[model samples]
Target: MTASPTAIDPAVTGRAAALDWVELSGYPTRRNEAWRYAPHKKLAELSFGPPVALTTSVPDLGDLIPALDGPRIVVVNGVVNTELSTMTGPTGLHLSSLLDARREQPDRLAVHFDRVKSQISDAYMALNIAFGGDGAVVRVDAGATLEVPIHIVDVEVPDETRNASCTGVVIELGAGSSATVVETRIGVGADFGGSNIRTTITIADDASLEHVLLQNVPASHMHLSNIDVTQGANSKFLARSFNLGASYGRVAYRVDLAGSRAHADLSGLFFGFGDQVLDQQINVVHSAKNCTSRQTYRGVLDDASTGIFNGGIDVLPGADGTDAEQSNKNLILSDRAEVNTQPRLEILADEVACKHGATVGQLDESAMYYMRSRGIPAVEARRLLINGFADQVVDEVSIESVRTWINQRLGHDDV
Candidate 1:
């Protein structure tokens, strides 16, 4: 006889729900508003085979991993690599693998799987829920404050036959806790198989978190991610992100400010060149009173590259005294470069403040002329201008090592 609902195993039930979702909801198309600016052809051509276990030795990072001194976790090809991961100097902070959690504490990830499904119904999320048997799990205890940041690294290794991998990450912070976390995603080879990842973050009341996300996948890889966040009363969330590499890379964020006096400060920089297609989608909802959010993103495109930034801020009917702002700036360095930016606001509350703006333009020729007149070479002048444009977001990164790493990816030596 079949087990009752209370007796059903969480892992099996979660996978069954995910399979049902996969069968019911297929991949998104261009007609879908959220995917309107996405590269539908590239997304369509992606081949998601099965998850490949790591059989060979891992390759060297070689300047890809940043210089960080903290507790670290590494996920390779949708599986955790214990040989390269370390946990130190942080008490009350815990790390575990998704496989272990499913085996021992089945309720941890099963709830998040259901939460993500309730919030969004997408093929990538469904794949992640169904095939994500291994990854990283991080949790901080109540009233614990960590000085060192936790670094989580994700590496994608190309398979001989070109397959796909799916992974999941879940971060939780208890009440009155404070910590910093960094996430880095990079690929090993040029013939990279696609990787789909899902991340969920939950912050309790009066907690604080600082986050950094960097994606510099290989040239021939496709990187897709879904990040969902929920904040409690008086909690604070600060994030700085960079999307500098990948042939077809996209990151979507869904943030819900669920409690009064919560605040979110977020910013990102997307620099593309060499026919790359980079995209970013951000949606923030103010669900409680006196919650505030700000989004500032910049894009720099060169060669025949394409970039898109779609951001929205929504204030619900009961969310009075909400304040939100959004800004998107683009810089095109080549004639063939293109950028599509849209920043919008929707308000159903009477007493709320919302503002959004977007601008797309080229370098200041007059500034270039002035710099050239002052003995700065044309190439150096252009580099300086582009660096200056991107520094606005880079400077917001609180960590110096991450700042230097991002500068290197952007081809700038210094901040």
Candidate 2:
């Protein structure tokens, strides 16, 4: 007699071993330091089951690509969809799929993939590595300057059968090279049936990379993303992230300046409405001399939504003459809305300049009253003031179209 679905005994196979680790690492309480503040009880308890076979072909690339010019890579459900992406550069700039790269350059992939060694003791990170399916592989040539940006879109399509954890992406920039990357996530409706995604990036000596992350996933779905990067000598990296969707979402980022004269600028904006819960954690590590880093994050919390921000900077013992600063400012638009902001700095070096501070409050009563007294309505005045407060960080984004989109979403365009 044929065995029933549940009658089949559980077997530990190749990928099953990895899934076991993922499940164990996702436990809410013990052995998972990365999930300390942002527990995955809701996401972990749900039975996503096994990843099913890929059925749908690659989606159209027309809407995914930005209007501007640059290279492009499209990853759907954590797997690279080659038909939807573009790569522009000389032969030295290797833009290939993760599977192709793994087959061709196993040694390089082994060294660069999941090489971030930190004591955060994050179990999810290892789980991500072990279960990573396929992702984009971008390797810039030494001294090559990618004049335009690289747009990477990781979209989650609604599924009728199983929920999947999509692919991951890993990028490596060679010495003296430069590139910009834009990552966007899209989901339809309030369906809790989609994919979870995680990604990582690395920058080499004298390399520079600017990364923009946009999240507008389904309101009912859940996404937990983690990104880690390393900057070499004279390398510079800028990260601008926007969180706007999902009932529960959290993104953790870590950047290490391991070479002299490296620099990093990390900034983020989050909008929490409804019962959404969004959390962001960032860690900047300065391991060499003459490194500089800056971080700024702002958020708008409405309804009963809650947001959390924890920014940390660590200057190692031998790292001298470092300059670092971190700031987090939040605005609560409703009485029940809540925001938790924490900015911290740990420096062991004797010679350095660093500062960290955070503030959480509502709209200024005096300013609001003054605007109301002038002829502006209460809603308009509040919107104007809030937009102005967040404008400084938005202005730092290099992409004009993205900036415009962000502004429009924040209701600042009309104001």
Candidate 3:
């Protein structure tokens, strides 16, 4: 069952405003346009228990996650582990939690929470706010650079089917500052267990942030997440995501370019096998002048799996000089594999340049034959072709260590 108001009162949910949405309208269903392709029967079969504090008994992180070049924030179960996190980060970088922010930066936290809460639009987000325990707050001061990328590693142990993990993260970058944040998530068990995470980001004027997300859960677990980003004037926000494994996974994104000359770039790859189903909903709004946004997502489906990409770019009135591009291409490897893609554009502004395209196809037999003629086996040729299709997204990671780690995970790295 979903997190209804009857399951837990909104009064005791958190310190913010009461989450009355559940009481107004129950959980999501197939009728909910965003969840039309989801397996609703299994979603209702899962339940999230109350949040708890994690101890020092962390999982084998080295084996589950990549070895990056920066500080790490470990979230065992659903709470952040201090014993594993680097308390002191690079210059001008600060770390705080929900309790810490409430105790020290109460007004700031309240303002941020208010801004992000109004943008919420789904039941998964409601569940996150109602059941999410102590959340993480990451901030970077103005005019300062974070020396290295900060990694947030979230792991959920296999437990009772009724138990799940819920957490929230808030990232704020001051004006003119720059940093990279990588989120590595794994360990949604094969049982009926699941994970619900919500992250909100704000980039100040002239600031820049590079965000990367990695989701490689089990083959029969539910993984859900929501990301909301607001950009200021001259700000730059880049995102690269890889969704490898999940039985029912939905990654939703809402980006608002609220200032002139702001840019938002998102590139993602999803590879599904077995009976897995992967979906993405990306909505980028251009409410400012001279703004640009781009979305490029690729899907590789094998076995009896399904993939869906529903993306949109909206340019509101008076949002002149808006330039946006969207593309989604899927490679079907098995006869039973399925793919449904939609890339749309809604422009109500002047001097706007918007374009979108979606394609679903199989491997190129000519390329396979060319490779096999050069002493490469047929199986090896197909593998290389798949890697080449995925590299378009991976090559944009920028960070060497993170890119290397991704290559190793995708089995594309040379020994």
Candidate 4:
């Protein structure tokens, strides 16, 4: 017998109201331009039950990446596991559970919570706000520079319930503050369920933040994520994403340059093997003058996998001196694989400078042949070429451990 969708806890009145509102608004369909290429039918048909918190042993991270000396927070099945987490750092760096923050520091959480939510009209984000579970809250005090990186690990435990899980994160960087955050999402078993994650980030004036996201879940699970960022004057934000696992995954980013001279750099590398489907959407809006934005994305598709990249840069009116660039490149390794890439730019300001381009093609046969003719095995040569193609984005990663881990995951040594 199959399980049915579970009901929201009546005790949680706020979540109940949000869920009601989401249901009334309805989910996205193929007719929606933003969701045209997504697997709308599959998502609409899936019965997502509320997740049940479970305590399980933490998995080893040694095999995934090098051991870094820093503070780490772990969340299992949408619930923060305090026992498994380690925190040792300077003062004024606040890291705690979102729920705890809300109860303890309601004033601090009020302004940042859902600040960018209104700018986005996505139904999934509404669903996350309604039914989302526990997540992390990171705040850096002004003039505090955290030398060590902070890691937030989200793990999905195998269960027969087949429920859906949601995680929400809020990050705030004060003026002149600098920090790095790494988020890793991993799954444990074959019977894992789906996940919905929403993150809201705000960088104050003169602040800097470096963020890295890794999604490595089971092939049977579905994943949906939305990231919204707002930058203040002269602030800088950098983001790097890695999508390596999932049966169906969609990641969206919305960045707003609200302050003059603010800057943002976004890059991603995705590998779609087997029958996986990966979709990425990025939208950057220059609402202030003299803001700069750059985006670069690369993908590798094999077997019957499918990949999609839709990136857009918009320079609004009166935003003079805006500079923006966007590029997406994909490599198709198998005839059965498919990819769709679109790069768009809208310039309402005549004084702005912008360029957008995309390319979708297979490896160069001539290069492969040349390597093979030089005594290199054909398989090894193909691997080498593929690695070289992906290295362009990997090499941009500033975190040494993350770069090394990604290279190893992509079979860099074999190549």
Candidate 5:
């Protein structure tokens, strides 16, 4: 039986009032401009109500935690996994559970929680804030540089009935602090459908944060995520995402440069095969003087898969001396594959230098021909060219081991 919307826990009732706001805000129907390119059938029809809490043994998640060697935290089905997680951090780093942290550290929660709006009226984002019960609260103390990256992985365990899960994460990076964080979503074999909703992150002044997301959900799953970040004065933030699973998935990533001399970089890659659909929307807002931003997204669509990229850069009035650039590139390896991209720039400050561009096409025929001329097979030739195209972005990852792992995952035989 499909769960009802009222299935939410009564204990979180008052706090759950936000879920109603998400539904009432607006459904992304076919007519909606923002969602027109990406259909919301599963999202609109799925029973996204809360799941019934039950005691279940935590299954073994091998090697996932060690991948994040630094201080880390793990959450399974929306609850913190203490056994597999860690609390040791830099002197300024504060890590705690959302519920317990709020009770004990209300000031920190009050300062950063929900500071970014779902004002864009995204249904999934609103629902997350309303119904999400358990989550992580992270605070990077000023001038503290963490030696390791924080790894957060959300897994959907096998179950007999279709289930809905919501997880929330709040990361606050203080002035002059630097850290790296990786978020991964994995799906196990299950008889029922799985749906997920998660939301917001905040970066403070002069701090630096490298955020990476890896999603490998099952083909029967439906996932939607929205990440909003606020950059303080002189801060630098880098955001990278890899989406590789689910029948339908959408991610809305937004960054607002609210402090002067701050900067933000956004990069992402998506791979979709079979009947999968992956939609990625990125928006960077420059609201302060001398702030800079850049965005680049690449996608590989195979079989009958489809993907979309809408990246926009907005420089507000009085935010002079801003510099922003945005680009979207796609590789379609199959005739039946499809991809659409929208790269937009809204500049109100005349003193700023802003540019945007997009390209949609097949593999480089000439480059493939050159490789084939060397007696290379057509399939292998195409793979070589595609690998070269994607390597530029993969090279940006700093960790040698992680970078090597990512390259191997992308089917690259050589560095």
Candidate 6:
């Protein structure tokens, strides 16, 4: 028998009530503006049974991404696997499993757990919070600066039957602290499954955080992710994402600048091939004065794949001196490929400066011909032009190992 949406699972804690609340709304349909481009038919047809106990062994992730000189936390099947993790770091850095935090640091968990739940009405996010299992909890003490990056790896072990996996991550940066966090999602097997993930971040006054999210799961899987961030006064948040895998993937980001002089920079690159579909949505809210935000996204589609980009910026009535800009550009490599982009801006403050634009088109034939006339082969010329277009976002990645991995994926490592 198929499991009901309100059924409670033993693996998750304090989520049965949330599950029941989400059941009323059910799944999203094409009528929902945020889910218009999503593959609702395929997602709705699948019947995922109740959440199963995470009994699979942790897969070796050493070969997935290049090794970096920092601490690593690994999660397999939505559960933390300490046997495969290296959590040693600076004196002020603390890394532990969410389950452990709930047991030993209940006070801290109580302060942030489900705090943003009421603010978010998205069905997928509600479902994630209702069923998510243990994830990583990372905290940096005040005035501490970590010299190395922290990596969190989430992997799915293929199951013969349809199932669901959910994970929740909480990150807090204390006042005057700074750190870099990298998250990677990957899976195996050829069977269809669902992966739901959510991450909430809080940056205190004068703190800074550089976050990188990479999704490269199997082509037979469907992935949904949500990232919500809150910034304090004079804080900085930089986000970079790369989506190059998954049969149908959707990622949404909500950033709120609640403090004066805060800044946010968001950029991403997505490549789709075969019959895959990728969608990226971003919403930035300026609620304080003297804040700034910038967003730039680029996509490349080949074969019969489709890509979508929707970004919006909003300035509140009191958010004077707000500066925001958004731009999205897509390159189509085949006649069968398709792309849709929408950029929106709502300015209620008279002193705000905001602009938004989007463009979808084929590669520059003139540039391709110019490279070919210089004695380059057609294939090489095409690759060179694509690489040049993608480098605009890839170059902004600050971490060396991540930069190298992205370059290798784009076939620009050697060049």
Number of the top-ranking candidate, with lDDT as the measure: 1
The all-Cα superposition gives candidate 4 an RMSD in Å to the true structure of 3.3
The full ranking of all candidates by TM-score, starting with the best, is 1, 6, 3, 4, 5, 2
What is the overall TM-score of model 3 with all chains considered together? 0.93
RMSD of 6: 2.9
Model 6 over residues 281-360: C-alpha lDDT tens digits? Answer: 89999999999999999999999999989898989889999999998999999999999888867888878889888888
The global C-alpha lDDT for each of the candidates, from Candidate 1 onward, is 0.83, 0.72, 0.80, 0.80, 0.74, 0.81
The sequence of per-residue lDDT tens digits that candidate 3 reaches over residues 189-286 is 45557778788899999999999988877766688888889999999999998888679877888999999999999999989888899998899999
For the record, the alpha-carbon RMSD of candidate 3 to the native fold, in angstroms, is 3.2
lDDT of 2 by residue, 1-415 (tens): 1232122222223235444554655444534343454645666643343233445655554443345566677666555666767865545667877756766776676654434334223545544555555567777888888767677777665455436454567788988898887787765444465455556677888888988887767786776677778889999999998887778777788888999999999999888999888888888999999999999899889999989887889999999999999888999989989987776678899799999888888999999999999999999899888888888778888988778767776667832
Question: Which 10-residue span in candidate 1 carries the lowest summed lDDT?
Answer: 1-10
Best by TM-score: 1
RMSD of 5: 3.2
**Tens-digit lDDT track of model 5 for 1-415:** 2233344233344334455565466666768655876656656655554543424677667633226567767667666677867867767778886656756765656544443344545666656655566567778888899887887777765365466567777888878899888877766665455546464677778899998877777777777777878899999988888777778777778889999999899888888889898989888999999998989888889999999898888989999999999888899989999998887778898699988888888988888889999999998898888887777777776766556656666678865
Better of 4 and 5 by lDDT: 4
Q: What is the lDDT ranking, best to worst?
A: 1, 6, 3, 4, 5, 2
Which residue pairs of candidate 1 clash?
none
Error of 2 at 15 (Å): 7.5
Clashes of each: 0, 4, 0, 0, 2, 0
TM-scores of the models, in the order given: 0.95, 0.87, 0.93, 0.92, 0.90, 0.93
How high a TM-score does candidate 2 get? 0.87
